[model samples]
Structures are given as C-alpha cells and as structure tokens.
Target chain A: MARHVDVGDLVDRARQRQPRAVARLISLVEDASPQLRDVAAALAPHTGRAQVVGLTGSPGVGKSTTTSALVSAYRARGLRVGVLAVDPSSPFSGGALLGDRIRMQDHATDPDVFIRSMATRGHLGGMAWATPQALRVLDAAGFDVVLIETVGVGQSEVDVVALADTTLVLLAPGMGDGIQAAKAGILEIADVFVVNKADRDGAETTVRELKYMISLGRREVRGASWRQPICKTVAARAEGVEEVVAAVAEHRRWTESHGEFAERRRHRARTEVEAIALESLRARLSARHGEALDGLAGKVMAGDLDPYAAADSLIADIKAEG
Target chain B: MARHVDVGDLVDRARQRQPRAVARLISLVEDASPQLRDVAAALAPHTGRAQVVGLTGSPGVGKSTTTSALVSAYRARGLRVGVLAVDPSSPFSGGALLGDRIRMQDHATDPDVFIRSMATRGHLGGMAWATPQALRVLDAAGFDVVLIETVGVGQSEVDVVALADTTLVLLAPGMGDGIQAAKAGILEIADVFVVNKADRDGAETTVRELKYMISLGRREVRGASWRQPICKTVAARAEGVEEVVAAVAEHRRWTESHGEFAERRRHRARTEVEAIALESLRARLSARHGEALDGLAGKVMAGDLDPYAAADSLIADIKAEG
Candidate 1:
C-alpha cells in the first residue's frame, strides 16, 4: 500500500505546504525506495531554494544549542526555518534519543519552524542517501533556511556537511587538543568557525588556536577576495548568536554578490550527479557479470594479468558485447 | 625494470632469512603492482604458515607496548618473530616515529626478528591493499608468529585487524566511556582482549564494563564452545603480558581443535580473491566502456529511470550481449 502511494501526490502535498505530507515523504526517502528516488529527483528543483547552513563539531560541543538559537533568530525575523539534525544513532533503532530535538522545543509550536532529526544510518561516506531526499522535502515545505547539524568530526561527516552552502564548525573550551579535530580535516572546509561556550575558561585560548590554525591554512589568491570568518558564542545563553547569524548573512550576501554561490551549487550538483552515476554503474557491472568475475578473479589469482588490465579487458569485452 | 625481478630468487632469499629481500618484496607488494599481486597469489599456498596476531584499539591505548611485550614474551620462548606494524601515515615521508619500535628496540638487531612498518597508501579500506603481499613475504621469511598492529581503531581499521588469525583489542584505564568504542563495534570482533595501562585509575571499572558488554553480546550457539578471553595488562612494565599470550595460544588451540582455522582461512582467501577480481573489473570497465558509462549516466541523471533498475537493466543487457 505504501508502494502504491503516487510519489507525485506526495510531492504535490509537500509543495502545498502540508507538514505531515512532507514528513511522510521524508520517511519514504529514508526508506530508500526505488519509487521515492524518482519522487526525490522530481522534487530536487524545489531544492537549491533554501539556504543550507551545516553545523558540525565534536559530540559535546553545543551545536544543538547553537542551532536552536539560530532557529529562534531566523523565526523572530518572521522566517520559516527547517532544522535537519543528522544524528549519529542507528536508524534500525527507528529513532534517536532526540536530544537535539528536545533542545529545540522552544520552537515546537511555532509552525513557522520544522525540526527533524535524521540518523546517519551507517551510510558509507557519512551523508545518508536519504539526506538529499530530506532536503528536498524541507525545501518543498516552504523553509527559508535549513540547518543540518551532524554528530562527529570525522573526515566522512565533515565531507557530508561540507556539501552545505555555509558550513559552520563549532568548538568548545577545554577540548584539550579538540582543535586537532578541526586541524585534521574539517577546518579547511569550514566557512564559519564558532567557539561555543565562550564563557568557559580557556575559551580565549581555543579561539586563538583556531584563529592560528585558520591563518596557517589561508593562502592569498591575488585577484579573488575571500576570507573565511570566525565567530565566538556562548550558545547556551544566546550570546554572540546574532554575530554568527550576521556572519552567515554576510557570507550569503558575498557569495551571491560574487556569483560564487551559483558556481558552488553547480559544482555540488555535478559531483552528486556523478556519484549517483558511478553507484549505478557499479551495481550494474556486479549483477551482469558475477560468475565471469569469479572465474576471471581465479585466473588473476593464479598468475594472470594485472587486476587493472584484467578490469580493462573485462570492460572492453562488456562494451563490445553491448 | 622492477617487475622483472624473479620471484624464486626473492623467495629463496626470504627462505634463507634475509630481511632485506623480505623488505624489498614487502615494498613490491605495497606498490600494488599486478605482477606483485600475481607473485603474492602464487605464494598464497605457502602462506597461513605463520600465526598472525592483530592488535587494535583506540589510539593511545598502549597497543604498541602490549604488542612489544607480547613479542618479547614470544621471543623469550625461542620463537622466530616478525612484526608488521601497519601505520596509516603518509607514505611519502617513508619514516615512522617508531614509538612502538622504540619499545621493541631490544629485538631490533636480533637475528630471528624481522620488523616492518607498512604505511597505508591508496587502499580504500583501512589496511594497506598490499597487506596480503606483506604477509606472504613474512611467511616466506620463516617467522613463526607475525604480529600486525593496526594503528587507531575505526570500522575499517578494525575490519582489517579482524582478518588476522587472532584479533586482540587493547584498552586502557581512564578510558571512561571510551569502552563505548568496544561495547559497540570493535570489541565484538576481538578474540582476546587486553586492558593495557591497567596501572591507571578506573582499571577495575574498565574490566567490569568490558565483561558486561562482552556478556551482553555473547551468543550461546549450540555445538559451539568458543569464548572470547579478556586479560588485563600493564604492558609498559611487562605485567600480564604472559597471560595475554597464554590466552592467545588458547584461542589458537580452540580454533584448530574445532577446525575453525581452515574455515576462517578459506573465508579470508575468498575475500582476497574477490577483491582482486572486482578491482580488476573496475579498471577494465573504466577504460573500455568509459564513454558508454558516461552516456548511460547522462541518461540516468536526465531523469530516465531508477538507478537500481537502470543498473538491473544494464546488467541484463550485458549478460544478453555476453
């Protein structure tokens, strides 16, 4: 029966600003149904319409509080906001602790704000296959801005969040080498850095360390003027939240004015589409030539041609046969 | 020129106990050459001749010290030992900090000891793709026991370590909630557990937590009598190293007595062979059918069909063409 639901109807209901309909569509996408993939493809045009702000850092960082504050700030200006919190819990568990959601309860009845927690679902490379799907749903549901907060500082999670329009990396004080998380891989990708819990001891030191790290990685592209911004915040008390919001607004304006936004979006589109293509090809190849692969593999194992050449020959044969 | 080197000469040198030749072959495997893969394949039958022990845990768990102590204990018993420390550092540097090497310096010049540090290069998975090649080299080098210590603990690194004959997960005191790393993914993969740095506080609590976690995950399968053993060690001081070694010996005996060794080795072989085959197919597909792939991908992204179905259809077409 769920399969019989026309993806078109779901998309239409979502576009009509029906929250339940959008939520249902998101569930379908999370399930990764073949039919829903079609719906998502159809719905993508509605996306690239929302300002995607990504938040990522170590687990204990107050990303949730910062996101909550941002949501309030966006709504206070009469803007509808969607928070797509990518929790690291297992989807098989069917739901997260929803701790991030609980923190955003101030907007529970706002109707102008939508808060949804997404599980990473153990997807390879960190971004859930369902993430793009969720983004589409939120876009169709009439959100002005989408805030995506992910769990950890690993390379894969950072890569996923880097797909966002404005990637904000959050840090906290006393993370003793917590800057290591940023310096390792995530720092280079961030558009805005936030030293959350700025009231804590060593907050100044953390900020300085992050500042030093950022400056170290910076290079002068003589003709182009682009410098990633850093902000400090005591997110729990909402101090400096306005500064972060303003920074994001400034970054957005700069990107739009410089035409960098369109270029970045196009680049992301091409990469995502290509990834889809590669996944498709791999699937096809595996299915069509399973046994031949096994046989050829045995030969390769037994003093045959190099794996690369064997692959080339197989592809040639496949193409010739086609 | 490098490919023309005779395998027999290399193998003869290795058999005659030449570490230089063994190191050269290991480097050859690390290069991931098709010819080297073929040579390693031919050498597979002569492999599984060494007791391969995998040491893994969170970073700073004193895995190196535990491994060093374990090696020292084995050598004290007159066993020929080889250490393959798989470092996930930059290969271009071609130098290890030798933190673990420092601990094991007593055996650096020992005639029966061969220690090699393998750097991760171009391997999609955590372990070096040339790991099997290195193992074969170590085997031919006549080492009775080859200890492969994988640096760091993540899903892929743990999987690589699990490939060993006996996987030992080392933990340390003050690893509060760090045991969460074990309760979930890497711990279940352990055949033997070693609590290193037991001299630190919370040692007793760490032990209790592991026991609880292990017991929770244990399956009482009918007709199967294997139980994973946990040992606490102050490896820096060589305390409890002998017990960890004894547990390892016991696990080996249990595996052999139950004929699990042959089955595990067979599974490993199948995995290695399949990887080789798929890798070969990927290269072949990319080179010969690269344009066809581009065409199909364009169509798929242009909203033609579901990628999985497109994949299915492509496979059918390939099989039909074949």
Candidate 2:
C-alpha cells in the first residue's frame, strides 16, 4: 500500500503528542524512506529543544536499570521522555533484550514515554548514520528529554558522545577499575560517571578509583564550565538516580551558560550532514561503478594494479562519469 | 628524513625475516603515507599465504593469555607468527596494555615473531579501514600465521571476523553464560569456542552450556564439512593450546577443500577495496568541498533545506565540479 504521507499532518499530530504519529515519524527515519527529506524539512524547527542525554557502559553494567529509573524520575516531574536503545547486533534478529523491556515495563502504559530499540543491521557506519535522525524525530515529537543508551564497547561510545549533550558513563564495583575504563577510551568522553549497583560491595573503591583517574587526566575546557561528577546509584532500587539526573541538568545549564550548547549542536548537525552526504556519494558510486569496482579488485588481486592506484583510477572514473 | 623508500628493498628485507622492515611497512600502512600505493604494489604478488586467525573475548577473559599461548604453540611448530593487537582505545594515547607485552615477553626477541599493536586513533571507521592492509602486509611479509586479537566488544568483533579465515571466541567461568555470548553476538561468528581458565569452578558448566547453545543455533554451511568445536583451556598454564591449534588447522583444511577459503579471501579483498575507495572519496570530498559541505549543513540547520536534499545538492555540486 504505497501512499502519500502528509508531512504537515504528521508534524501536527507529533506536536500534539500522538504516540502513533511519533512512532510513524521515527519509522520513516529508521527506514530512510524516500520521504525522509520531507520529514526532515518538517521536523527541523521542532528539534534543538529536547535535552539529549546519553547513557553507556560495558555489558553487565546496570545501564538498563539506570535508564528506567531516570525515565520514571522524569515522568514524575511531568516531562515527556523518549528512550532510544541502540543495539549493536544483527538487526534481523531483533536483539532487543526481553529483560530490558521487563525492566522498563513500569513506563509501558505511560503515554508520555516512548521507548524504541535501533539495531545496527550490518550497515557500514549504520548506528552513527541513523541515530541523529531518530533523535530529531523524538525531539520534534515534543519529548522534553531524549535518552540514548548504547553498549559502551569500542566505537559506540564515541558515536553516543557525538549525539548526546551530556553523556553518562556507568560503572560497577567489580567490572575492572578506572584504568580499564581509561583503556576503553570512555573516560575522556564521559561528562558524568555513575557507579551503579552501589549497594554491592566495593562501590566505594570504584568511586575512589574513578575520581583518582579523572584527576590525573587533563580535562578539556570548552568554556566556563563545571566539573564532571561521579555519583553512586543502586539503579535497580531507584536510589541515587535523582542525583544523576541533577548532574545532567547541571551540565546542561553549564553548557548553555557558556554558549557551548549551541556550539555542540552545530557541530552535531554538521557531522550528520557530512555522514549523509558521504553515504549518498557511496551509493551513487556503487550503483554506477559496481562492475568497475570488481574489475579493479580483480586487477589488484592479479598484481596488475596496486589497491591505492586502483582506488585512484576508480575515483578518476567516477569523476569522468560525473 | 623524507628520503625516498625503496619498496622492493623493504619487501626483500621483510621476506628475509627482518623485523625492522616489517615494522616500517606497517607504519606506512598505518600512516596512510603517500608511498602506500607503491608499497602495496610491491607487496601484492607475495600476499595471501598466511593463515589469518582471529581471537577475541571480553575483558578479563584471558584473551591476551590465550593469544600468548597460541603464539608459543605455533612457534614450536617452526612457523613464523605475526600478532596484530587491535586496541579499540585511543590511538594517540598508546593505551596498549603493558601486561600484554610483558606476557608475550617470551617471543619478544624472536625474529620470526612480529607483534604490533594498532589503535583506532579516533579516525572514522579506523580499525576496519586499517586492519586489512596491516594483515596484507603481514601476509606478504612471509608470516606462516597472522593472529589478529581484539577485545570482543560490540562492533570490533564484527570487524575482526571479516579479516579472519577462522575466529576463536574465548569465555571463562563466572563471566556470564552462553546467553551472554549470544547477546554479544559472537556465537554466530565463532569457528572455535574456548572455555579459558578451565581449572576454575563452573568451567565444565560453561563448556556444556556453550555446546548446548551452539547445537541449538542453525549454523551456516559455508563449506563442505565443518562443525564448530568447543575446547577447554587453561591458557595461563598453556593447557589445551595444542588442541586449539589443531582445530584451526582442521577448519583451514575444510575451507580449502570446499573452496570456501578462496571465496572468503575474495570477499575480504572486495571489502578492503571498497573501504579504501570510500575513504578516498571522503578525503576528496573534504579536501575539495569543505565550504560546500558547511554551506549545506548551514542550510539544513536553518531549515532552508532538509539534510537529505542538502546531501543531494552537495553530491550534485561534486559531480558538477568533476
């Protein structure tokens, strides 16, 4: 059933807080449908209003619990919230954890809350490409706050940092030490640190270690700013989560006062544009030059051309075709 | 210092088992030096002989230890080995674990063993872009086996699987279960599952659980005859390391006989070529059209143009300029 989607109508319903409309808009973004240009044109003005917070941590950390607690806290304050869980797994398998849904069941009936899971689906640079648009959809749908949660593994943490206004890096007592966190390259990107599962043993040790590590590292001064805070939370029991929320608010305020918020958003928009442009060019190249690419590869494999020269020739061919 | 490098001489020295020559060639690859095309051209005919094996597991799961043990085992067979440890952490920070080096001290002085650590360095798609060339350099330099070790965190595993002919997924007792492995999405990519720390409590349970899970999943038949094997190992003590090697050989034999080996290599080559081409296009776009990109992004941000439309316009501009 191919039909027209009225961008104006969708925007109106989204502004009116219609969950179905919001879901449809997000689906449009996820699918990268032909109407994506219209959807982006429609949603652009309504964005830059929602507070984007990113939550990430290694597997086995209480990211889901913390996210759930924060959602309830925001809902209690009468704010609309949206949660985007980026799953870096096979998209066809729907790898969204059942445990995550059960933990988030508290807000399942709350119309003010929208939770969506995005899978990588094996696309090249897929998560980084799709997330900004998804965030925009939620932001335009009138959510007061949007929380992006991702597994803090390798590049995903970097990707989340680029999209979030304030990023929270969660840790647990026995999940290695501050050095390991530093080794994971998350320490520098973290705006706030949460030692979740504080009710467990060695929470204090984790907190102390993180503080020591943070102290040793040189903090980049974007502007007149605040210090990154480390909070302890038993997210499962909803303890100390309010403190995390407060830290996020505090960071947001600091960024706004220092004029860094606008700067960050501008950088994000530029990055999103570049990613899309690159993807578009790649698609065009592949569609137009599939045979040429294979021929070049065959030559490279047969030692008739080096890969670098082959790449140069391919670029030249693309330009000539253009 | 900017003197010309003789690519043929470097390749000759590398084939003659000179570690300095191998290191220099790898540096050229990592830096994306202008001479990389010449280097690749010189090295192409000598490539594709090494058996590439990928070893990955979660942090603290004895991946480094297992890798060290396997290296020693391979060396005992009078085979030259190359180790490329992909650190997903900061490239500039050189966050490669001192423990990794200290553990592999046994082979540090062995001319036949070349160990190198590669960091992501904050580049876009850096690891995936750099690993293939690095592997090719090693393969062409006459290593009998090249072991690619990466932290089994999220997307890094997927990257490693693409470059390896066989992949070994390591697990330990008390580090969660087969379900956790499935959640991590490593179950499907693994050719061999190693229960490291087999002396620890619950080791038998981990092995059995992994076996049961592997049985339940539908394995893709890429070759004539092969079944994923589960092995138990105390890597620290070098126990069962030989069995892992034997399994790698068995998988290699199966793939070669079934023609999957050539097929996989062709796919790997195709992927590498595509990555290089894409990177080349991105560089060209940035160099030749920086202002155009910024202008498009500005338009998108100001709501005058949607990002998709802006991208289309940007592509059009590039084509026109070409």
Q: Which candidate is the best by TM-score?
A: 2
- Judged by DockQ, which candidate is best? 2
**lDDT for position B55 in model 2:** 91
The candidate 1 chain B region of ten consecutive residues with least summed lDDT is B89-98
Q: For model 1, give the TM-score of chain B.
A: 0.85
DockQ, candidate no. 1? 0.15
What digit string (tens of lDDT, one per residue) describes model 1 on residues A1-322? 4447777878888888778877888887766566766675567546557888998775456778899999988888888899887754332223344454577888898877888877554423224345655876787677899998775433335445755788898877754333344322456567788888889888888878777766655652211466767788988898999999999998888888998786666544433443343444444445676666566555544434334344554565556654
CA displacement after TM-score superposition, residue B20 of candidate 1 (Å): 3.8
Candidate 1 per-residue C-alpha lDDT over B1-322 given as tens digits, one digit per residue, 9 for 90 to 100: 4448777777778888888888778877776654674556445545557888998765456767777888899999999998887655332223244345576797888888888877654223324245655776787678999898864333335446655888888777654333344322455567888888788778888888778766655663211467877798988899999999899999889888988876665545444544444444434344555565555555443445333444444444444544
Q: What is the C-alpha RMSD of each candidate to the true structure, in Å?
A: 5.9, 2.4
Clashing residue pairs in candidate 2 (N, C-alpha, C atoms within 3 angstroms): none
Q: After superposition, how far is residue B55 of candidate 2 from its true place, in Å?
A: 1.7
Clashes of 1: 3
Per-candidate Cα lDDT values, in order, are: 0.65, 0.80
